[model samples]
Every structure is written in C-alpha cells, then in structure tokens.
Target: MNIRKMADSGNDFLAETDSPLGLGESGKPIPSSPRVLSILSSVFERSIQKNEKLLKKLKTKDNVTVFHGSRAPTMGIGQYIDRISKYTCCGTPCLVVAYIYIERYLQKMDAYLTSLNVHRLLITSIMVAAKFNDAGCHNNTFFARVGGVSTKEMNRMEIEFLSNLDFRLHVTADIFRAHCLQLQKEGFGENPINHRPSNKTRAKCLPQIAGYTCRAV
Candidate 1:
C-alpha cells in the first residue's frame, strides 16, 4: 500500500483510541484523561519490555544462529545493523544510543498526547536515530517495510506523535555516546557486543558514564 492509504489506515485506527479533535472541544489536555494515559502507559511498557527482550536475545552468545532462525533471511537485527552501519559509517553503537534515547523519553513522559502507537513509535525512533548518526540515511520505503507500515502512515504517525510531545525533540542519549566512547578508549572495549551484560549493569553503567561525560562536556 502507498503512504496515503497507510496514513488513512493509521488515522482510522487512532480514532478508536481518541480523536485529536477532542482536544479543542473538551478544552482539556488530551493525554490527561485517565483512559488515554492508561493506554499509553500500557503500550509504552510493553514496547520497552519487548525491546529489552530483543536486545538481550541479540546479545546472547548464540545470537547469530538464533537470530537467523527467528527472523526472515534478510531482516535479522545483525543484517539490519550491518546495512545501516555501512551507510552511517558507525557501528551498532549509534543504533543502541538511539534506542536508549527513545526508551528514556518514553519512560519520562507521564502520558502521551494521544494513545501511543508503540509500533509506529519504535520505527519512528529508529528513523530519527539513523538520520542523526548516518550520513546516508534516507529511505522512507525501507522504514515502512521494516515497520510493517506505509511511508505515508509512518510520516503521519511521526507528526501526530511529535504533536503529542509538543514538538520537543530531545536526543538525550547523545551525551551517553561520548561517555561510552571515552570508556571504551579507557579499555571498556567492544564488550557490550561480545559479552552479554545484565540489564541492570547495562542500565547503571550507561547513566554513570553519561553523567561523567556531561560533567566533562
């Protein structure tokens, strides 16, 4: 399907959650409503959990074989990262930074402007990340294909998602990248890829490194 058709489908699907039109009619913050907030929270939590699981699976010792078994021949995370890296001239580190940024942002928001569409949110986040880190990141069709949405739909979803976010696009995790680089220079090495760190260790170490970097910056 084309972008316009996909966008239309998204609009219809989102309408079931709540209309943005209701914002003006009710004169209340759209996301403040309990129902919408609940839905957004649920969606965000589930998406984060799934992302974490996927990351863990990918970082496992047997990841190469397992990833091949779990994904289509052409669409495994490794293949995806490899393709992106060739264009970006950066390794999976850039993608990890972007994912971390998206997750942190979602966690901070008390609610979404509309019911959060987790799938679209994830794809959009990845697109934004690619644009930030890759010099050659321009493929709406690829994003749509990977996201199982249409380019038009993805664009519309991005706009709506940003609107709900009040147009504030903060790439908070960029600082973390600098810190991670420094740590690696100081001998942290490429262990994050080769060795599976516990989620808690990953989470804790990232923030601490980011904090140090921020002070240095």
Candidate 2:
C-alpha cells in the first residue's frame, strides 16, 4: 500500500513513520484516530451518495442520452442544449456574460440554435472570457481542471462551438460595464491592483440585475 502525507507548510512526510503500535502488531486492529475516521467516513458517505445520485440520474432517458452522446454522437440538439445549460450555470455573472457572447456569436452566424441551449455556450464563453480577461489563467490544463472535462474534450468542444458560431467571438461590452456600475453604486471600489471587480457587491446586485435583464429580454 502506498501512503502519502502532506504536512502543513512543511516538508511532506511521504514515507511511513515508526509505528507506535505493539512490538508485534500482527493481526491486531490498529484503531483509527477519531478525526481521521470521521473524515474518512464523511468522504465515503459523500462519495456513495454522489454515485447513487449519478446512477439514478443516468437511468433517466434524458441523462442516458446525454451520457451516451458524450461518449459518441454526431449531435443531438436537446442533449447539447441540456449540457450547455448545466455547465454554464456552474459559475457567476462572468459566466453569464460568457453565455451571452456564445449566443450572440451563434446568432451572427445565422445558426438558429435555440436559446434553450444557451447553457452549453456558457462553458465555451467562460473559456473565451477567461482568455480575454487573463491569458495566464486560460490554458488547456486550466479548462480541463475547472470545467471537469479532459483537455481533448474541451478542445473538441471549443472547435465545434467556434465552428457553429463561425469563429466569431462576441463578448459584449455592456455586461462588464453593467456589473461595474452596479458594484460602484453599491460602494464597492474596484481593486486597483487586479482590476477585478468586488464579488461581494456583485452577488448582492445580481438578483436585481437578473430580474431587470429578464424583463427586458
């Protein structure tokens, strides 16, 4: 068995330390530490529950179609839309803005892909947005890690999305300005160093903006 231990801000203790168990600890159960046991139990329980939920969801027709299509499919419109929405909602206003970009790009291409699949566009939008905002943070590995898709998968999706939208990236100027205005109105000063707007103020303002945006749309 391989044991790996990482110490807090210190050198990692990958090798096993001398056992404090009996001289001959053979066949005797070494009781687990309460904290360790609690953590392990919680992790196991969560994993089991997550797997169970996934299994149950996969049994459904829609989800089964998505999972199967994810592996191999030319294109299923409904499944594509579903995946887009699911992935996009996984982030914040920045993500929402990215979603808008995807939609506009698609619209400009004369691709009548339904607004229903606006979600999938979000994932690509986020990648584009992240790249636009900070190239350092927008890499294949970064997308793979954050998006929970393999680098190959992300690349494929990116190409497909771009092709569908005729390679025209249309990130709106309005969303960022709107968010900034809202933050300023709420007395959240922009960070001078990073130039990133405050998330706390944005969170507070999101509901109001969403309602207004929805009404206008």
Candidate 3:
C-alpha cells in the first residue's frame, strides 16, 4: 500500500476501520503502536525528503544543526521506532505525544526535519513524551542505547529538547483529542473528524482518558 497516499485519499474506509482505536471509544482497545508508527514513519520519511530538496537550495542551517548527528544513523526511521517500542514498551500514546512535541518544536524553531537530524530529534522527543506520559519509563541511558546514541549525548539532547520547547509538556484532553483526530485524518484522509465526542452516551473511559496523560491501558 502507498503509505503516503493514506493521507491523501478522502475515503480510506479500510484504514479507518481500525485506525481510530484508542480515541476512548467503548470496546475499542488502545491503538496499535505498529500501525501508528507506520503512519508516523511515512510522514517523517516524506518530510525528510522534502526538506532535503529545500535545504539543498536554501543552504542554511539555523536551529536544525543542533539536532543533526555527526552523520546519519544507518537504521531506517521505521525500524528505529519499532526497536524503541519493542524494548521500551512505552505504547502508542507516547508515540503520538512525541509526534505532537516534534511538530510543536518544528513550528517554534522553523527547523527542517532532515535525515541527518530526524533520528536524534525523534529519540529525544519520544524520551520526553515517555517520561511525561508513562508511569514507569526508562532513563536517558537506556533510551540512548535504543537510539544508538551515547549516554552523554542523550543527556544533552534531552536538555536541549526541553529547553527548545520551554519545558511545556502538559497536553490537555481537548488538545490530545485534537491530535488524535488529526492522526485519524491522516490515516483516513482529511475530512476532519466531524463526530463530536459525547459525554452523553459513551461509556466512561476504561482507565480515564480526559485531562490526564493518556494512560488508557
């Protein structure tokens, strides 16, 4: 399937069937990390290629340089995400939160997500999201090894990432739902989620999803 095209087609009925899991709907389980990671990875790959072309012409670094590795890591971004999920078991909410943070930082910095910097940025953002959202999370050293970075660099990256975002990590329920909506829009194409969530008829979240850090397990 064309991963990039998933975001383009307006009626992705098949993808939508299971894609909207973990939106705190009754009987639906937490979203699958592999499925969400596939979508996120496709977006990252497209962004890197698009930014690569743009940077070649512009030839300027700006804040992007801070995240750039000494050289690009050999592992594919999808595989790297898989490895992190496999070992850390931080789950889909953390991955989605990391996505939100990455976009937030990019907007703040106007930085391009290039191949040289994407992996490092992802590792840092995911680590921060894990700490913020997960009950028991790994330390910087464990995350560093998962991302193929050193403990020292991981420490530096975490501080730098937090500093760049001004350490604002509290994602509210509405904001989280909006992000989930956007993720669904990408997977099922951009009609924009029209169904207003009702406190009216839905069952209470199995583990309480609103106004908290999305621990719906």
Candidate 4:
C-alpha cells in the first residue's frame, strides 16, 4: 500500500495511544477508541473461511480430501482477538503486526485459513508480533492456555510460522496504520465479510482493548 506515502497524503495520521505507563515491552499504549483488532479479525477470518470453502468446492470433483482437524471456536474472531489482547497485554499495534504475519503466512504456505489452523495461526502470529514489536511478553506456555493449545504445540507453530515468514518481523509504523485502515474499510459495519461487533458493543465488552484510536482515511 506504500503506506508511508499514504501517511504523507494526510488521509490519515498516527497518534500515540495514551501511555500513562510509558512505552515498554508492549511498545506504545493501545489507542483508546478504534476497533481495528475486531475489524481485522473479522476480515481475516471470513477471507480464510471463504477461500477454504472455495478450495474444497474445486476439489470435490477430483475427490481430493480436505481435513478439518480442529473445530471453529465458539467465540467470534473479534472476541477472540479481544481475549488475546487482554491476556497477552499486547498493544493494539501487535494486532496490526499479527495481521501482516498472517498474510505472509498464507502467501508462503499456498494454503487457505481454516478452522483447523486459524486459532493456532492467530495466537502464534500475535505472540511473534509481541516479541518483535513489544519490549517484553509472556512465554509460550502462558499463550498456550490463552490460545487453547498445548505449550509444546504453540512453540512448534511459532517456529513454523516464523520460518514461513522467513523470520522477517520488522513492520514500520506506517504499514501498521495502513493495516488498521484497511481493516476498517474492509470489515466495517455490514460489509458482508463477517459480522463485526459495533463500537458500542465492543466498548462494553473490551474496556481495556478499546483504547486504540483512528480516523477515516
């Protein structure tokens, strides 16, 4: 998106989230208003689900089998992201970085996101993002419980995910903002990618994670 240039165009701008605690392992404080995490989660989740279904459709004639080893979670993607945010104490920027990692993973794996892999992918990406972007973070064992996977499995997935992305963990601030704007555009109200929690609903549900701020681009 050449997000750096877009930032210069003045369609949108970045403002640091209120950081009473100051920046530390979590990078800047999460902005206190934008629903970027929820939007991105919805968008990414729907894209993966749709593409997985499409691939299966094409394979039906050939009798090519697809295995869905894990079931989809009861919590929606937005809610799931909220849980990750709260449990990991990752800044909102981590959500943006995690989205970037997921895109890279899909491109590299030549695979669609699916019920079997999405939760694992989401958790691993966020954990990796936090380690790379946040100054400090919890260990894999902690994230394992948060993500409903064993610590060993979470560790394995983290390695595999990093290798998939060629260990490129740096994401510029402009790119991070660009991802947020993209999610807002793509996954905002009634766009049909998936249902998104409204700002009001999210506010009540995610008091801590709701601090991220954004304006229209």
Candidate 5:
C-alpha cells in the first residue's frame, strides 16, 4: 500500500478512526493513536483466547513455538505494546503494517499467537515494519530494550521472523485496505474474531487500555 507515500497523497485509503495519528513532519503518521492501540491489543487478546481454547481441546499446552522468548513475560499485551510505542515512537501506520507482518507469519508458519510468542513476534514485526515503511528506524538493540529482550535474542528473532514469513513483508494496497477494514470491524465488535468487550465501538468497543491516554508523538 506504500503507507508512507499515501500520507502525502492523502488518506483516501484510511478509515476515519486510524488515519490522523499517522501524520508526521515528513508526511508520515506519528507513532500511534490510542484507538489503533486499543484495537490491536483487543485483537491480540482474542488471539490468545482462541489459542487457549484450542489448546484445551487438544489437552496440551501450546508453547512449542519459535521467536526468542524462553517464557512468557510479566507484562500484558496492552502494556507491552504501549511500551514499544513510548520507547520507539513508531509511526501509527507502522503499527498497522506490523499487524500485517504478524498475519503473514501466522498464515505461512505453523505458529500460534500465544503470550509466550506474541510479544517477540510483535517487536519483530514492528521493527520490520519501521524498517520497511519509514526512511529511517531504530536498530535491533534499541528495539530489544523496548521489547524487554536481549539484543542477541532480538537479532535471532528478527532473522527467524523474516525467515518464517520468507521475508514476505511488503503489504499491497488491497491487502492493506482489507486488513484495515477487518480490524476496524473487529475493533467495533460488529463481527469480531472473538467475542468480548466492544468498547471500541465508536458505533459504541476495545476499551482503551489504561495509561494509554496520549498519542505517541
């Protein structure tokens, strides 16, 4: 979709809730909007629940996965993602692109987005998104600190994430639009991937996570 390029041409591609926060001095969107953060965190919460249900049915845990984490970290999804934005000041569009990267990895790899793996995957995806969508970006060492992982582990995770998705990180316009629509719908709980709170429903849904009161500027 060339998200960075789209910023200058106009936001014909973005939904009402997500476009404004992505704007930067160079025409790129700033770090992120609270609404987008709330929405994506909700989606991740659903993913965790769905995977847990599947695990229950299989009668086994599902921690046998890739990425660099040895155990699930103490931070919850909302806090962790909020931390990433605060530290890196990543553009809001990069967050969407990062979600795209996560979707690509899940669609291609035999992996699930559980707590143990989701954080690492998220950091890796966002890192990739920043590198791809922005003219300049933070190095892996900085991202490792943002993600609460060791630098070496961060490097390993970046390699594995690219490898698992076969380096297919580019998001086309159609795909990007479709994802935004689905995420918006999912956020509003009109037809969510999982059933739960829909405080993000500007139509009435993702209860904005606490402490995320400011946009990443």
Candidate 6:
C-alpha cells in the first residue's frame, strides 16, 4: 500500500467516519483545555465502547483478531489527553491529527477500535502526528512514558500503525479544516480551558474497566 495512492483516494471517508474534535488557531478559539478534554473523553469512550461491543460479537463467532499488545491505562481518556497535550508538544493539532490517523487505521484494517487497541493506538498516533506536524517533538521514549507503555512496545505499535496506514500522514489543508469544522460543530468551539476536572473527577468519569494491558505477541 503506497502512501501516494492512499492520499489520492478521497478522504471523504474520513468525513463519513468519526470527524476530529478541532484544531489550529482559526475556526473558533482553541477550546479550553477542559472543553477539549471533555470532547476527547466522549470521543474515546464512544470509540472504545463501540469497538468492545463489536469484539464481543466477533468473539462469539470465533472471528476476533488477537491484537498483539500490552497496555495498562491508569489515566482516564481526559487525563490521558491532558498528558498527551503536554508531552506531544504539538498540542491540539496533534490530537486532531491523531483522530484522523485513527479513522484511517479503521478504514484500512477493517478492524474494530476497542479498548484493547484504542490506548496504544492513541499514543502511537499522537506521537506520529507530532513528529509530522510539530516543530519540536519529543522522542518515542518520552511519549511512551507519558502514555504508560515501554519504548519497545511503542516503537512496535508505531511501526504497525504506520504499516496499517500505508505510511500516509499527510493531512491536506482541506481535510484538516474539515475535521476542525466538524469538531466545532460537535461543541468544542469557544469553550475556555480554565476549568479542568480534578483527578478524583477524572477517575469517576472513566469507566471502571477502561484500563487494559496489551503486550505485543
């Protein structure tokens, strides 16, 4: 799978699937950290639940693909996103790019995005996106620490994700703006970043069973 070919393919599919929460400095104000956190929490939870339910059905049919990984997500999605925002250096745009990468992975692999894979996927995608978009990006080891995974595991997942994406990381201006617009439409436009949830609140908000530990086979 060539990156060129994949990019040439209409990413209208992205518009159809989960759109990004928002990005850049234009659309509406960059959402406040709390608002961005809320949007990401909802998006991650929805994707995880949707995929987990799908996995259960596939398991019944003996058709589930064993995702090779080990992950123990101590932080809830919001907290994780907050950490990612700090570590990735690419900030909100990286999150937007990560969301786009997730969409691409789902389309290319024909795989469900369950809790088993979402954490690793999010970490890897954000790292990759930061490298692509940010002027000064952290190394994979640093991101791994922030993401609660080993450097080796992160490297492996990064390779797997890039392979699955056919190495396509380019987000055209149009596609990027479209995702931001969708995110704004989804209610992230103009929320101030002043109000962040406490650790207790985040813990309460995260699903009790949200954490997963995946080690590469």
Best by lDDT: 5
Per-candidate Cα lDDT values, in order, are: 0.37, 0.35, 0.63, 0.58, 0.68, 0.58
- Per-prediction tally of clashes: 1, 4, 0, 10, 11, 11
The ten-residue window of minimal lDDT in model 5 covers 208-217
Q: Candidate 6's residue-wise lDDT over 1-217, tens digit each?
A: 2222222232332221122222222332122244545676677787778767876777742123323344434556666776666444443455666888888987887776765566677878888887775545678877777777778888878888888888988887667657655664565454544443334322211212232333433
Model 5 TM: 0.78
Per-residue C-alpha lDDT of model 5 across residues 67-118, encoded as one tens digit per residue: 6355667688888887787667775677878998998888887667877678
Where is the poorest 10-residue window by lDDT in model 3? 208-217
Off by over 4 Å in 4: 1-27, 31-34, 60-68, 187-217
Model 6, TM vs. native: 0.67
Give lDDT tens digits, candidate 4, residues 1-217: 2222222332342323222211223433443223455466668678877877897888832111121233555666676676776666665455666778888877876777765566667888888877765455778877777776666777777887888789987766566557656755674464442233234422222333332211111
The order of the candidates by lDDT, greatest first, is 5, 3, 6, 4, 1, 2
| Total backbone collisions, model 6 | 11
Cα deviation at 71, candidate 6, in Å, is 7.3
- Model 3 stretches astray by more than 4 angstroms: 1-31, 62-64, 189-217
Best by TM-score: 5
lDDT for 185 in candidate 4 is: 66
Off by over 4 Å in 6: 1-32, 57-72, 188-217
For model 1, the superposed segments whose C-alpha errors exceed 4 Å read: 1-90, 111-118, 164-174, 177-217
Q: Give lDDT for model 1.
A: 0.37
Mind sharing the TM-score for model 1? 0.37
Question: What is candidate 3's lDDT per residue for 15-131, written digit by digit as tens?
Answer: 222434333234232333445666778788978888888877898654545578656677788877766665566545667678889999988888888877888888889899878
Full ranking by TM-score: 5, 3, 4, 6, 1, 2
